[model samples]
Target: MALDRLPAYVRKLRNAAGEPVYYWELPAWARPVKDEKTGAMVPAMRNGKPMLLASEKLGSDLAEVHRKAQLLNAALTDWRKGAEGASMVPGSVEWLFQWYRKQARFTSKKAKTRADYGKLMDMLAARETKKGAPPFGKRRAADVDAAAADRLYEMLRADTGPRQASYAMQVCRLVWSWATRHYKVTGVKENPFMGMGLTSTAAKGNRATSRAEYTAYRAKAVEMGFQSMATAAALCFEGCQRVSDAFGYVDPDAPDRAAIVWEGYQPGVEITLVQSKTGNPVTLPLFEEVPGEGGGVERVPLYPELEEELARSREATRSATGPIVVEERSGNRYVERRMSNVHRRICDAAGLPKDMTFTGFRHGGITEIGDAGEDDVRPVSGHKTLAVTRIYNKANAEKARRIAGARRRHIAAIGALDEARTK
Candidate 1:
């Protein structure tokens, strides 16, 4: 016979708990035999000897490597016992992810999905490169670890669209799960993202920013010496538009008057421009919050310089639509040059903190609305929901009642003490 004995196959010397046991001899059909140092072993025939191959699969210490070994072995024990079940193998995590990414590329309905994955892959590569001294391009998907995935999430936290980050993770995660359930023909369950939640990589990020910081940021923007920053800041405060929405230079379509009306109903104050993002038209009637008289309302008017800017926009775009602000005398379009110039000026001049971005304006507005009142502040802020309106209402009903009760008891005790003294 060409072969004296069929090649000696591998049998894991570990149990479901990953406790190692001695093995004097194993069947030739077995494929996975583990040694203590290597954890899982692959066998190769050399010079009439069966040797085990080992390598650093994690590239770092996996705190639960033993646990994973246990799980892998337990799941594949039937195959090792010659029972009709799936098998287990090493380095199957990569296979699962690769298969998932391929399926995602095929079945994704959104046109932007492929592009999104492309960006994610690039980001993952760049992040891994930064960790080690390796060349940037050398970091591949197979090499990504939990540490790298954690960083990828942090970068995507600031996206403006709600739940985009959550949805993106779901796409990749679903694929990983599918691989584990379907692809393990050899009884080797491969789920790389298992226990991912235990790591910081799977944590949800904070999105809310308070109002006080946003107000200060306005001053900082002016200090930044941006050409139109001062005006944009004024727009943010008076107009209550997000920085991106606040393009200090008004839309060319706005009417010449500072009272460029919009459909947004911000309680009593009229907004001069439409918010491009939500397209929620509002009209905040002009009036100081006149506490007793239900806050008087009047036509939306602008301060002199703001009025002048609006006028200039009209003069430039007389050929176009109304409510136009700061436009080139020659062009039909409203170039953002003046607006961008002013924004930078304000930020540099104010020396604002690095963390404050243009979006913080909206956060500030939310806080301001909260400060106005609670019982029925709906008219002033136009908050459609109590949660939306009550952000400012920090009043605790239980605490207030307790304070009142304590005051009454103190008064009664004082009166009794005074009678005793008189007697």
Candidate 2:
């Protein structure tokens, strides 16, 4: 390939190992020199080394190599400008983002959360002020008021979907909140993304598994020889727990024993653990009438059907410990995605709606308890707040009417008893 035809400053060099490598060479002024205080060489007099572009070592195709080269060149250009003290303005959105990434608020996020936030940041970085204006990242942070934020949110929702737009707004709100408390950035008295009423266009996930639907799905699972999946479904509904927690059991010998454990079964058996997502401690009873407060018997019954399925799973696995749900072929614990596939297959076989999900079992169980006038279903559902518990309850007008009719019947029974006593 001709060097002249390639982007400027992006040249191929032969490494000491006699392999071709592409590198983006810095200008003389931008090149590293020894720091007087540290007595160490740094790239662009910064803490990093010179940029290495695509190479045969990367094993990327030609197009990907070229794309990476372009990105590296853009980053080098920014570095060179920074070296000349002519980089992004101090109070610009780009500068704020750079600072935000270094803060505890951003760094402390989980790996998955950070990755999602990174995608949102990339989307913001690619956005323009207007159709052909400068990149949104380079715009002044102070210029983003509530109205401007709303307009940007509307545009993003239209361009992307509601979920992505809502997430982006959340990221923006976090950055702005941190800036308001820490940095004295101008025109940021309050977070612009706050109280925006940005709603998700996606449908609400309020579907609950009906008893018939669950029974059909379980029958299909058994017929397909996926007894483990049937066991998982039974646990989710009877235990009133998420599928992840129901199937996340690990053996004592496993490396992640500290994170997940399979507590052995006994009468009034319960698995006491902290939820992975919410960190809420929950005690899931495997049988009815577990010991309750003040020596009163609280009914947390394990249905006969669920009990039978669990026994079948135990007999099939032939193990007293380890994950309750395992692939018959591999005899290994099911990952989250595999468990999801099991649910999807069962749903398909049962002729259930596509939107019917494994989580709906928990929702259905919670709603059933709620309909029975159980004031507290949080112990079974492990919801952190009553509000969250209520969200899972899918009771509608029909359920309300049934409860009203039951109340009237009870009142008539009381009247009959009183008239008989008077006579």
Highest lDDT: give the candidate number: 2
lDDT of each: 0.38, 0.63
Error of 1 at 340 (Å): 9.8
List the lowest-lDDT window of 10 residues for candidate 1.
Answer: 52-61
Candidate 1 lDDT tens digits, 1-423: 222222223232555677643322333443445433323233433322232222212212233333333333342342233212243122233323334445644346343354455344323322222432432223333344566555544444554222444444554455545644654432324434445453324334323334344445544543442223434444454445555455523332432313222222232333335555444433333333223445655332223333433333334345344333332332322234444444445555556554444555544444443443223323222333223233333242222223323333443565687889999
Model 1 residue 41 lDDT?
37
Model 1 regions more than 4 Å off: 1-117, 126-189, 198-236, 242-279, 287-345, 374-423
Question: What TM-score would each prediction reach against the true structure?
Answer: 0.38, 0.54
Candidate 2 at 346: error in angstroms? 5.5
Candidate that scores best on TM-score = 2
List candidate 2 segments past 4 Å from native: 1-95, 108-115, 128-135, 138-140, 143-148, 184-191, 199-205, 219-229, 249-262, 266-302, 315-318, 325-351, 370-423
lDDT score, candidate 1, position 143: 46
